[model samples]
Target chain A: MDFLELDAVTKEYPNRSGPPARVMDQVSLSVRQGEFMAVLGPSGCGKSTLLQMAAGLLPVSDGTVRIAGRRIIAPPPEAVYVFQQYTRSLLPWRNVRDNVGFAIEHRLGRRRAREVAEAQLDQVGLEGFGDHFPWQLSGGMQQRVAIARALAAEPAMLLMDEPFSAVDALTRLDLQALILEIWARRRLTVLLVTHDVDEAITLADRIAVLTRRPARMAEMVEVGLPRPRDAVATREAPQFLALRRRLLDRLLLRHDG
Target chain B: MTAERLLRPLPGLCVLALILGGLEAAVDAGLIRRALLPPPSAIAPVLWDMLASGAVLPPLLATLRLVFAGFFIGSAIGVAAGLAMGWFPPVFRLLEPVVELLRPIPKAALVPALMLFLGIGETMKITSVALAVLFPVLVNTLQGVRGVDRVMLDAARTHGWGRAHTLLHLVLPAALPFILAGMRISLGLALVLAVLAEMLAGQGGLGFLILDMQRSFLVRQMYAWLVILAVLGLALNALFLLVERRALHWQPALRP
Candidate 1:
């Protein structure tokens, strides 16, 4: 059995007039344990909605989502969603350390939670900046704090909804590398949703191509690139360019069509 | 410090001194009647005498007690109700109509009924002030809770936080700016209502002292009480600002 499964899941919002608006249609996908999967689609393709459903933040209007063979009705404990808008997602009142530790607030006492948060901050290269509030940090650093916060939950699966889309290009590259490294080290099952084909090619084991609106999985492209990837070397590689070209063509073709 | 910093308050201070000096000269020249508008100097001396004789403390303390007690009670009820109404649709649907009906009716108009039930005592005065404070706080808190960013709530939900935990940690802190803003407005209203209640009830408060002195034709003493009230208002406002600065230090706009 797959670690995470979305079997013909669909999402529809009720409208006051006319037919209900559909966001996802029969979107079926299965993620294996420790697999890094990226769902690539056009803008407003309901990719975020799809991730929300998988994270159990939104109810499935039809079908079912299962994690570890258990049906997910509400937010599942073993999964955490990293939002695209890191600045708004983090609690403004909490310092970087406190926000990171917020996940374990109920499970661990204050002291233990702070200790865990500090350790996570250290891992994310924010070691001495624990006392600084979210607004005090740069956009990239704030996103890093958000990542650390998600990790603090010690989730079995990390659901990232266009997580790096808000940063600068240089910062985006750095975060992409950092996330890949973390995934490798932790052996985490990650479902990253994005419109950036290059990003999908860079990090994912398999790229799940999605249709424009009322999204459905169109194709699954296997990324044959070797692990322990380097930013400069990986992009320069023939396999990387080939995979990037294929994914981009698929995304653009579907978008234009 | 910069030259600009040094001269920041100069214009206001100069204008105040000029006004006081002008008023004193006008009164001495008999252009303005002393009985109608006592000069600042005469009012100052009377204020000093009242403080020294310990005559002001009882009324001042009474007013303070009413304001604070009403402020706290009103704030507690307002925040609790606002949180409930904001988070739960059922609660909002049930209470919204009743709240709207009561909100527009001036609190002073209810004083007669309140006095009839509770008597012209501490409870009546405090309840009047509490009613005055309640509306602004409750309305602001509800707006604040409703105004909380959707993505933040999504973040909380995705983290597996239950409704109670989410509201306690996420909603409350996010709504703090609104709550504090309401508190400041309510603080001023509380003081106003407390005095109004005291005056109407003929109770032992600064308002009563002012009325009592005026009836006896103690013009300077009445003027002195007015000064004390102005100072009290200024002091309360200053204290509230201090608390606001400390509490919302994390807010980017409020950062020093």
Candidate 2:
């Protein structure tokens, strides 16, 4: 059985002066255990909405999201959501260390949580910057703190919604490399949503292509790439180019329509 | 950095000196009546005498006591109510109409009503100050709590933080700038209402003394008390600014 399953998921929002408007249409996808799956789509697509549903942060209008064979009603303890807007997501009042500790501080006392946060920070290459506030760090560093926070939760799954889209290109590449390393080390199931074609192919074990608004999963293409991917070499390969072209063409078709 | 900090206020201090000098010149030249406005030099000695003789302590402490009690009580109630109203829809709906109606009527006008109920005592005076302090704080805190980023709230939920934990750690801190801004405005109102209540009640604080001295035609003493009140206001405002900057040190725009 899939580790996470979205079964015939549909989402609708109440309109100001009309019937409910649909944003996601009967989308169903499944993520296997220990897989790095990327949900790629055009801008303003309901990819993030689907990811939120799978994480159980949003109530599904007409379907069930099951994690570990259990129907998800709220955020399950085995999963954590990493937000794209790291600046807003992090508590500015908290130092980098405390923010990372936020995930486990309730279970573990402050002292124990801080120690765990420090270890997570080290993994994310943010050692010795624990005392600094989020505003004191650069955009990339702040996102690293956010990633550390997600990792500190020690969940079997990580749900990320366009997590690195806000940083500079060079910073984005660095983050991409960092994520690949983390994934290899942790062997955690990841469902990352993104609008970037290159990012989807570069990091994901499989790419789930999505259609435009009121979107549904179009197809799931296996990346079939080797483990421990490099930023430059991975992109330069033939398979990466072929997969990028196929996904871009599919997405562009919807854009043209 | 120390030099920069010291020099920061030089321009404002210079302007203040120029205004005081101009007022003194006008009074000395008889263009302004000394009976109406005492020169800085004349009031300076009286202020020094009051301070040195420890006569400044009583009235100063009394007024300070009223302001502090009202400000703290009012701020605490306002924050609690505001967070509830902002966080929970039912609470907001229940309180919205009553708050809007009560908020607009000047709290000073409520002073007479308060005096009628509580009579001319410290209770009446502090209550009046608290009423003045409450609404601004309540309104600002509500705004702040409501304006908290939705993403952050979602983050809190995903982290498995319960409602109480979220309110105390996440929601409260996120809304702090708004809460503090409201409290800053209320601090000034707290003092104003305290002084006003004291005068109206014919009480023993600085306000009453200023009024009493003027009526008795002790012009110098009245100006002297007025000067003390002005200095008190300036000191309180300076202290609040210092604390506010420190509390919001992490905010980039608020960094000192």
Candidate 3:
């Protein structure tokens, strides 16, 4: 059974003067428990809009998003969104530990929240950097804090929108490795949005290629690369190379042709 | 560390001393009449006596009380209204016209009107000072609130933060720097209004004494009260800066 499902979801942004601009045509997708699904598309392909709607952050102009067989209109307690701009999402005024704790503080209060936050920080390899503010941390570390914040909420589903796209290539690899390890340990169903073909091939259980603007799901390709994957070896796999080429062809056709 | 802080002002003090010494020399040489511009040497003794005897407390306290009261009242209302206006469209729409109508009118010009209603007492003076402090704070807070990053608000929503949680933890801290800036600008205006209101009131505080002494031909005493007012202004500004830095320790511009 699908743990999270986006059923024929369509998004249209209503403009002030003109008619509503359609962002995504009816796109259906579903993720089983403990599955990692990556939505691969070109830039400005409404990938973020799809993820946001699934997270219940943006309302779908058409269709329903169901989590655990229940339709969700607002952000569900079982899911959390990890934003791309980690710098903006992590409150600058708050230290790293406090920012992580922000997710659960209202429920657990300060002292308890800090203990939980520390454990989450440890899980994300940010153990000794708790008291440091977001502005003091590197971009990669800040994103780890953002992930730690989502983990502290103890969400069953993580909706990530190009979370590591801003970090350096080396840092992005480290983050990808970190997230995969965490995802396995926690049994989380993750829907990661990205434009990078290699990222989709390396991380996802299945890749959903989206066509550009008012995007529709062009194809869903199953990533058959063996589990217990490492970032270094995953890219060079014959299967990984094939999937990457196929996605690139599908994504680049409208641009070059 | 403390020594460096203490020594930092030495240069400005030296400049002040040089100017004072020049004035004293001119007075002693009889190039300037003593009645018109008394030497700093002559004014110093009166200042010392008033401070030593605690005679400066009454008027000093009166003016300070007015400034503090007006400042707090005005700031509290300004921040509250600014948040409401920024967060809610109806509040902004309803209050915009009235606020705009009142905000642009020079606050000092309202003194006669305040006197007409509140009489020539503390009430009139405080109302005048508070009016001066209100608009800048309100407008700045509104700007700050509106300027809050869209991503931050979106993050709050996705993280399961409720309206009050978002307002207190997110909205207020985000707008604090702007609110404090408005308060800083309004602090100087508050003092201006306090002094002007006191002068117009003509019955209490240092402003009255300064004007009264000059009219009474007590030149050194007038200058003495004037020094007290100057010190008062300097002290208030320094105190505000210290508090502002403490409150916004996270801000880059405010870092030491």
Top candidate when judged by TM-score against the true structure:
1
Q: Give per-residue CA lDDT, model 3, range B133-184, as digits (tens).
A: 9999999999999989988998888889998888888999999999999999
For candidate 1, the chain B TM-score comes to 0.96
Question: Each candidate: what lDDT?
Answer: 0.91, 0.92, 0.92
What digit string (tens of lDDT, one per residue) describes model 3 on residues A107-189? 88989999999999999999999999887889999999999999999999999999999999999999999989999899899
DockQ of every candidate: 0.81, 0.76, 0.73
Which parts of model 3 have CA positions greater than 4 angstroms off? Answer: A14-19, B1-15, B21-33
**Clash statistics: count for each candidate:** 0, 0, 0
Candidate 2 chain A: worst 10 consecutive residues by lDDT?
A224-233
lDDT of 2 by residue, B1-256 (tens): 9999999999999999999999999999999999998898998898899999999999999999999999999999899999999988999999999999999998999999998999999999889988899999999999999999999999988989888888888889999999999999999999999999989995688988999999998888898999899999999999998898889988889754
Best by lDDT: 2
TM-score of chain A of each: 0.98, 0.98, 0.97
Q: Write the per-residue lDDT of candidate 2 for residues A1-257, one digit (tens) a residue.
A: 48999899999999999999999998888899999999998888899899899888999999889999999999899999999999899999999999999999988979999999999999999999999999889999999999999999999999999999999999999999999888888889999999999999999999888888888888889999887899768999998999889888888998988
Model 2 lDDT vs. the true structure? 0.92
The residue pairs found clashing in candidate 1 are none
By TM-score, is 2 or 3 better? 2
lDDT of residue B186 for candidate 1: 95
lDDT of 1 by residue, A1-257 (tens): 48899999999999999999998999999999999999999999999898988998889999999998999998888999999999899998999888998878767866798999999999899999999999989999999999999999999899999999998999999999999999999989999999888888889989899998889889989997999887556898889888888878888888888
